[model samples]
Target: MAKGAAKGPTVASLKKVTPENLASLGVERLAELLVSVAETRPDLKRRLRMELAANQGPEHLAAEIDKRLGSLQTSRGHVVWRQKPAFVRDLDALRRLIAERLTELDPAAALDRLWLFLQTAQPVARRFRDRDRDGAVAAAYVRAAADLGRLLADQDPHLAANALIDAVAADPEPWAVWAPETLRESSAAMAAVALKAARGRLGGAAPSLAVVRALAQAAGDLDALRGSWSLQALANPSVAAALAPQFLAAGRVGEAGEILRAAAPQPTGPSGRLPPPDFAWESAWIDYLDQAGETAAAQDVRWASFERTLDVDRARSFTTRLADFDDVEAEGRAFAYAAAHTDFERGLGFLMAWPALAEAARMIAARPDDLDIDPAQAELWAAQLRRRFPAAAHRLLRAAAAAAFRRREFKLCDRLTEEADTIIL
Candidate 1:
């Protein structure tokens, strides 16, 4: 069965949606139907029409959920959940609001409110049905039946982010009997999250590809593992430096070089007493880098950034997030070493890995075709790898150039031929 689908026979069928008893849908299509009902909930929708007929505040309903939930403050403060009140008070208000509205409004709005309220009142939702199979909610599972169909139809990256994967992987109930696409979509979601995580590490965001892939695979949604808004939002020049090594490990040498070049200072003197990267920015960067396979470099940055965030005297577990690199049993621990106990010499050594770091000004200007294993990128990585081993960039450059020339377009051939002197063998 698809991820996120509810298990067992249909609790009840909708008016027009039942096709030989909607149970025939494989996990994927069943999930689509489930998500569809979640968005509109026909029974609830008809009820909502009655409320609109009687003139309930569409605008009032639309009002930002402030007074009920209270103020929210964070980096991404505008995300709607900001208005959520404290657990007890929020649940009380939700019950009161639903009761008052039920007297006049239709079922859909009331249900929508109930859904949103359920999301907010997690405890109540859990009590009602704690299907925390994969760290997701039951509403999400039901919503999946309604949401997946539309999501598949839209095929947009934004809406179908984490919930679908959670539904399939986390389902405690036997929803497999009802939906197959739920599992299929969950697979897609895993891949999506993986791509996103890869993009983040390579692009100077957080190193979460491993996490997404690990979690999504367990949930049966490899394709869905492609995006992470939190990680993407944190990217910048400073963050890139911290993200460099992970990018290299993940087959994104160009992105890694780009971040390091921007963040690390130009070397001075033999040992290199470089200017410190901004502590605030470097702290987060170090956290991500530590997870990206450059442990020595990560430790080095950790020392510098920790000095910035903590007092000179305090000492505890130097950690940020508890990351899972591979599988749970064969994985790195969650305690991604925080900057608090990081050492400076290790950080410095990591910086030394990149010798001629000035080459990354190219990726930002690169287009899709220019994206094949680039020669310019090869040279930069070659400089670093050959330093520790006998690695060379010449062969990689030749292969990329050859591949570029193989394309039907004459323009690409001309371009590679033109830049050969500056970048390749």
Candidate 2:
């Protein structure tokens, strides 16, 4: 920087740079010095850069050159304007010049400055694109766009997010393709920006559906992009109104349901209570339940429009999921859940674990003398239940039904009789 420039840093300088000297240099000088050593002694520069970054964050350079130049007073009136660099007019100009010089030779330094510029200075991503289509801007934005795609996999979008996306798409590389590939600790912000862009294309006013589809394809996960779009629409009201119907029309009924469910306001404090339910909220809930295939739950809510509400169907659905559980204990628990509710009279219908449940004829003869079966027998039953779920072993349950029938215990007999064809797993 003083006159003669070295393409590679001096080995002696690498060895000579002590912590004390590093501490004494101005922030700008310190950054430049770090750059000088970066090419030849990259490992050491990396360690020092990380150290400086951890110890002194962005605030360290907030005052910058303007504040530094304040020290330039003179004894004589004609202030010999000799030593100051010609372009030290302001901090902005100085920062820009320093950044330019950094990108010219220092790869590490360029990356660091580029990160800062994109995050804090001015979204230099689009600016970089405008400035140079094929220079560092090309590779940098490609990486940025890719990283942003990973980010969209997580969050909502901003107003400026669309503009940023337009700029990214204006270039050759697609954001989704790079997101999974470009994602890294050093480039996380860029990834987040890209994700924000994905939200714009999917949720808002109909942009090219093809672009969003391509984004999904590039990210290699359509469901995740839809999830991100849902979140963004929920947070932004204008976004919600404009985009909700479009999302529904996109055959994302389930996703739209999730968004509205997530948006349904909840009471904040324990001391206070939510207002009495209105028709709108009930309708929204019913919409969510229906889309999610909780028909029983939706039906119960709908019953409020007429008379007494019985959640029998929802209870049955719950029973079904419970019986479908993998273990004997889990199946027993489902009965317990049914016990507290009306739909089931604490039915043992979920008990599919009896060994004979796999063989209809064996089940008829195997009725326990003591209703309270042994733990070992229960374990055996558990295994049988698992097999029943997978192998469709209806014979054991049929046998149990016949035994119950001969004993004049019709209810118990019917409980063992399963109609697997009737249930939709």
What are the root-mean-square deviations of the candidates from the true structure over C-alphas? 25.0, 22.7
For residue 192, model 2's alpha carbon misses the true position, in angstroms, by 16
Q: Give the TM-score of candidate 1.
A: 0.23
Q: Candidate 1 — worst ten consecutive residues by lDDT sum? A: 331-340
Give one digit per residue, the lDDT tens place, for model 1 in 1-425: 89998886545644346666566667799777666774755333433343454464644543333223232111222212322223233344334444355424434444344334433423334332223433333434344333333333333443434433333334313333213333344444444553444333333222233344344443443223323223443244444543454455566555554455555555578987775566544544554555556665765555444444432211122332224533232111211222112442222222223221222222212222333454455445545544333212333344456776776556665554454434332
TM per prediction: 0.23, 0.23
lDDT of 2 at 132: 39
Which parts of model 1 have CA positions greater than 4 angstroms off?
1-150, 153-258, 265-276, 279-297, 311-425
- Which ranges in model 2 have alpha carbons more than 4 Å from their true place? 1-41, 47-163, 170-174, 177-294, 297-317, 320-425
lDDT assessment of candidate 1: 0.40
lDDT of 2 by residue, 228-324 (tens): 4545455543434333444455667766665555555455577576543434445555655666788867755554422222233333433344334
335, model 1: CA deviation in Å?
Answer: 21
